[model samples]
Target: MSALILKDFYVMWKQTKVLLIIILVFSCLPGAFYPTFAVIYAAILPYSAMAYDERSKWDQLAGMLPYADRDIVLGKYLFGYLSIAVAAGLSLVIQTALTLFWERASDNLSPLSTIPLAVCVGVCVLALTLPLMFRFGVEKGRLVMFLIIFLVCGSTGVLTGISSDSLDGGYYLSLALPAAALAAVVLTAVSIPMSLRMYRRRRA
Candidate 1:
């Protein structure tokens, strides 16, 4: 399992430099813009990479190696999570830098706000992606991705309206962050088993 995960990471590292440049560009920009990019980028990276592997028939090749279905599924999930974490870290660094320099000067933004916001964004991304990946595999995950994007945008609009009218920033953060995290966790737990089962059945 560890070796398989390392292999996936190795493959991902080939594109890490490009991804880092993207992160840097997004991070240096103002506001929460980069965090949104990070979430979308992180969610898509694994699916895109896996879709390439599937296209190249790498799963079949991997099966010829000693890896089990669970190993493949779990490794892929871990890779996705790790990618999201790295993206989140880059966004945070950018946010911190901005807050330190710009926010201090303008007194316009809160550094404290970025953490929960980033986490919530990440959770929402994972929650959207995982179940799709489980049900559809990477090839069909694109359609699911589109639907998830629409749902997220619509839901966010509704939430923003509600929060703006009824809830303060802190109140909104207090409720939204934990709810997003819990939903992400539960979705992940459920989706992994489903993905594993699908992988095994397909392989069989």
Candidate 2:
């Protein structure tokens, strides 16, 4: 599993430098929406890796190796989880630094508050998309994934529309964050098993 994750990271580093650059640029932007985009977009890196794997028929080769289908499926999920964490952490730190150093940076971007929601949304995006990729090939799944991305990105507008005062730091921390966390957890719990089953069926 560790090797699988490392392989995807290497593939990402080699193939997706442009996307990574875009994430960095978005993270430096002055609003919650851009930072959220950075995190969620980072989460999609695993999907890109999977697409490459399919192009190379990695799954056929992987079946010859000792690792089980569960390892392959879970590896993608773990890679995505780690990617989201790294992006969310970076987005938060960058936003914090910008808010401190840049006069134009909006304090209302609220890195402390916004990052949790972004992470949750990223997690949920993986939960929604991974099973599709597993059940169908990456090529077939790409369209649905794009639609999901469009919807999720659109929803960030609603988040941005909410006034900082209405979000009420304490209320956000105590209520919204927990609710989002719970939803992510539930969706991921369900998603993992579905992905595992689909991958196994595909293998069979």
Tens-digit lDDT track for model 1 on 83-164? 7677667666776666677745235343235444555555556655665565567776678778756654554444434333
- Give the poorly placed runs of model 1, Cα more than 4 Å off: 13-20, 103-106, 110-117, 120-124, 151-167
TM for candidate 2 is: 0.91
Compose the digit string of candidate 2's lDDT tens values, residues 10-101.
Answer: 99889888988888898878776788778877878888899899998999999899998889999999999999898888888888888788
Per-model TM values vs. the true structure: 0.78, 0.91
- For residue 154, what is the lDDT in candidate 2? 65
Best model number under lDDT: 2
Give the residue spans of candidate 2 off by over 4 A.
163-174
Which pairs, if any, clash in model 2? none
Q: Candidate 2 deviates by what RMSD?
A: 2.0
